[model samples]
Target: MAAVVRGMFALEPAQHRAESCQPGGRGDASGGETQPVESGEIPRCLLVGPKGSGKTALLFQYGLSLVRQGRRVTFISHETLHTMPLHVAGATKPDPLSLKQLQILYLNTQEALLKFLSSIHTQAPLPTQAPLPTAILVDDLDYYVSTAQTAESAPVVARLCAYLVDAAYFISNKLSEDKTSVAGRILCPVVATVAPPGDRTALQWYERFLTSVWEVKGVAGQPTMYQLSDASSAERAPLVVTYEIGGTLRVLDVQDLNEPMEGDD
Candidate 1:
C-alpha cells in the first residue's frame, strides 16, 4: 500500500525548497521549514490579522505550493471554502494527477472543529501509509471561536487551541523519530488564520500555543504586507506581496521598495 501511494504521488528527487524571505525580513514558513533544516524545526504557526487582510489567500498559496510538490495537504476551513479552486474538493479514490493529494474539510461549528482536532490528537498515527508529508491548514479560526463564544462554551475554544498545539507536536514527533524521512518534509506543521481578538486577554491565550505569529495588514485591492514574529526573535520587517485575480502573484522585498515609484522623478 505504501508503494502504491508512493506511485500515486511520486516524490520529486530535487532538494526540498524552503520558504524564502529577503535579508532581515521574516516570511511565515507555516507550510514547511524556512531553512534546509530538520523536519520538525518549526511546527506550528498562527496568522493574525483583521478582515479583508488576505490571510486566507496567503494560506491558499502555501497549500497550493505543497500540492504542486506532490505532498499531502489537508485544509480545514470555517469559511471561504466555496472560493477555493474546484480541484481542492478532492477525490473519492486515489488519482495520481487529481487533487486527491489535497483534502478539503469544512467545519461550520466550533464543536465540530474541536472534535476533529481531538480525534487527530488521540489517534496514535494518522491512517495513511503514504510516505508523503502532510500539512494542515486551518482558515478563519476566529470564525470558529466566535461561533462558540457563549459563556458555557468559552472553555472549549481554549481546549481547541491546546489540541491543535498537541496535534502538531504529535505529528512532528512521529516524523522526527523516523530519521530517514525526507528533510524539510514529513513533519506536519499547523498553519492557522486568526483575526485580531476583540478582547485583549485572548492575546496571551494564543501566544501560549502558537510558536510563531505573522500579522497581515492590507486593504482590499491593495498589496498585502506580512510582518512575522516568532518565539526566537522580535517582529521583522514586513514583506509585501500583491496578487491579482487571474494574474501572477508578485513579491516585493526591502530592495524593491527602494526602486523608483511609477511617478518618481
Candidate 2:
C-alpha cells in the first residue's frame, strides 16, 4: 500500500492564525499544536503568516519545482488551487498525469484531511514505473487548531503532527536499522506551510508544540523580506536567493548585518 498522510495545514484556520491571550496561559510546543520528532534531521518546515501572506502561492511554486525534479509531491490548499496546472486537468478529480506528477489535495472542508490521508494510504499503485519520493504539503494549519472547541479536535490535530514526525523519522532512518524495511526507504521529507501565530496566544502555542519554527518579518524599506534570527546569531542567516510560485522566495536570516532592535514587540 502507498503511504498515506494527514494534512498539516488547511485553509479553514486562516482567519484565526493569530489570536491574543492573557499573560498566563497554557500554550506552546509540549501541549499545543506541535510537530514533535523521533530523531534524525528531516527536511520539514512550517511557513507561518496571516491571510494574504502568500502561503498558497508559495506552495504552488514549491510543488512545481519538486515535480520537475521527479519528486512525488502533494499540495493541500483551499484557495485558488484550481489555478495550479499541475494539480488538475479539464474537470474535477485529478488527471492521470497530474496524479503521477504529484498528489495535490485541495479542500473546502477542514476535516477532509483525515479522509484524504486515508485515500492516499489505501490507493492502488501505478504499474508504469517505481513510485516517486513523496512530499506532502499542507497550506494553512492555524484555522482548525484555533477553532477546536473540544479536546477531541485538538488531539486529532496533534496526532497528525505526531504522525508526520514519525513518518519523517521512519523515512530518514529507513535503511539505518539492521533489518531494513521497504516502506521507510521510499519516503521523502514532509513539508508543511503554516500560518504562524501573530499574537501572544498563538505564538506561545506554536513555540511549545512545533519542532521547527521560522518567522518572516516584513522588511522596513527593502523590497525583499528577511527571517528572524536567534539571539546568539552572529550574522544574517541568508537572503532568499531562489524564487518559487507566485514570486515566493526563500527566507533570509540576516541578524548580524541588520541593526539591533530596541525591543521586540
Candidate 3:
C-alpha cells in the first residue's frame, strides 16, 4: 500500500490529485458526527531543497500517500511547478478537496497571490462548526524573489511573505489553543526550491526569507543531496548523498552506496 519507491523522490499518493489517489475516503463535515481517531497520529512533514533537487517529486509522492489515507492536502506551487501538466491536472481535480467542494487557488501573479492569502485572514467561521483542517503545501519559494525584483511588485511580494509567516504563526497558535481544531489539526508542510544567489544582496535576501535551507549538488549523472542543518555549515560542509533510480522509491532500503561514485555516461 505504501507507494514510496526507492530513489524516486515523489510526493505521497494522497497529496496528488483525487483522480489518481483515493484511500482514506473523504472528509464530510456535514456528516453530523465526527469519527474517532483510529491512528492516533497525524502524518505531516516539511521538505526544503534547491531547484531540480527532487523537491516537487517528493512533494507529490508524499502528498499522494497522505491522500490515499483520506487526508485533505492543499498543494501550493509557484509559477514553474504549478504550470507543469501533472500539477495543473491535479489542481483541477485535487484528490479529496475537489469532492469536498474545496477550492485550490493557483496564483501566477503577485496580485492574485496576495488576494488569495488575504482572504484566509479575513474569512470567519460558523458558530456550530470548527474551521476546516487545511494541509498546505507551498512549492518554489524562490519565486518570491523574482516577484519582488520589480520595484512596483515589491509591496505585493512583501505582503505575501508576511502572509505566509502569519499563516504559520496562526496555525501554530491554533494548535496550541485547541488540540482538535482545524488550525490545530491542519498539517502544513512547505517545500521550497532555492538556488545559490548571484551576489551578496541576493544571498542576504535568501537568508532572511528562508528559516531552513538545504543543498542539491552535482547533476543528473553525478547527483548529491545535502540537508544543511547548521547555517554556517551550509557554506562549509553540507550534508551530501548521491542516488540513482532503477525500480521504486523506498528511502530506507537505499543501499550499496559506497562513495560519491561517478555517474553513468
Candidate 4:
C-alpha cells in the first residue's frame, strides 16, 4: 500500500517550538483567548489565478517552507502528480521530502480525496508520542470542482465546499486533540489554489468559506504579481507579492508603493 500510495512517515523530535508557536504558525491557539482572533488560529487561504500564474509553484513552495519549519505537510494534487516524474527528475538534492516526514497524497478525483479525509478521521490513534504540527496544501482546487461538476453523481458546488470544509475541520480536530496524545499538539491549516473564475460569481462560493483570498496575475516579461486581502473585504487594496525568477517572493504594500519616491520628489 505504501509503495503504491507514495507514503513517507518519519517521526522526528520537535526541533523548533518558536516557529510553530507564532501567530500564523502551526501551533495556532486551540481555545479560550477569543473566537476568531486567537493568536494560534489556523487559516484557510485560497489562491486564484490563471494558468501559468505560479499558483501550483507557490503552493509547493509554501509546503516546503512548512516542512522546513518542522511542520508535517500533506500536499495533495492531481495535476502535480501527472508531472511528478519530470519534477522528480529535475529535483535538487536534499529534496523537500528527503526527510521522509511529509505526507504527499496524489488524489485524482473528489471521491478519492473524500475517502482519504474519511480515513484520517477514523484512523486509529497514534501511540503516545508527540506529533509534528501539520498543514494541508491542495493544489488546483478548481480541477476538483470542475471534475465534480462534470460527474453525474457529484453534489452541488455549495455541498462540495461544505464537504471540504468538514474534512478540514475534522483534520484540525484530530490534530488538535489532547496534548498528551500523539495526534495532539498539531495545528492543521488548509490552503488551496484555484483557477480564476470564468464567471466572477463562481468566486462567491469559495469566498464564503475561505478565510483569506489571493489573486495572482502573470504577464509576459514581468514578475508574477499577487494581490492578497481578507475574504470579506471587497474594497481594500490587496497586498502585492512579486515572484522573481530567483525564487524571491517580495511582498510590497500598496500603501508603500503609493508614497512618492525620493527620486521622484
lDDT against the true structure, each candidate: 0.52, 0.42, 0.41, 0.53
Residues 1-265 of candidate 3 have per-residue lDDT tens digits of 1122211133233244322212222223344543432221222222345655556655555455445445455556655443322331122234455435322446776566556655655444456743433445556555655766565433543455556555544543343244354322233333334455455454444444333444444344444332222232134222233433223222322222322557844
Quick one: how many clashes does candidate 2 have?
Answer: 17
Worst 10 residues of 2 by lDDT: 1-10
Off by over 4 Å in 1: 1-42, 85-98, 121-133, 152-157, 178-185, 219-265
lDDT of 4 by residue, 21-106 (tens): 44234454546321222322545667777766556655665565456666677888884455432121122323646446666778
* Total clashes for model 3: 32
Task: Please give, for residues 19-80, the per-residue lDDT of candidate 2 as tens digits.
Answer: 11111011133332233323544444555654554456455545544454345676766555
CA RMSD of each candidate after superposition: 9.9, 13.6, 10.2, 8.6
Model 3: which ten-residue window has the lowest total lDDT? Answer: 1-10
Position 203, candidate 3: lDDT: 41
lDDT value, residue 157 of candidate 1: 51
By lDDT, the best candidate is 4
Positional deviation of residue 56's Cα in model 2 after best superposition, in angstroms:
2.1
Better of 1 and 3 by TM-score: 1
Stretches of model 4 off by over 4 angstroms after superposition:
1-41, 80-99, 127-133, 149-155, 181-185, 220-238, 245-265
The runs of at least 3 residues in candidate 2 whose Cα sits more than 4 Å from the true structure, single-residue gaps closed, are: 1-39, 80-100, 118-133, 147-157, 167-187, 198-201, 204-210, 221-265
lDDT of 4 at 196: 77
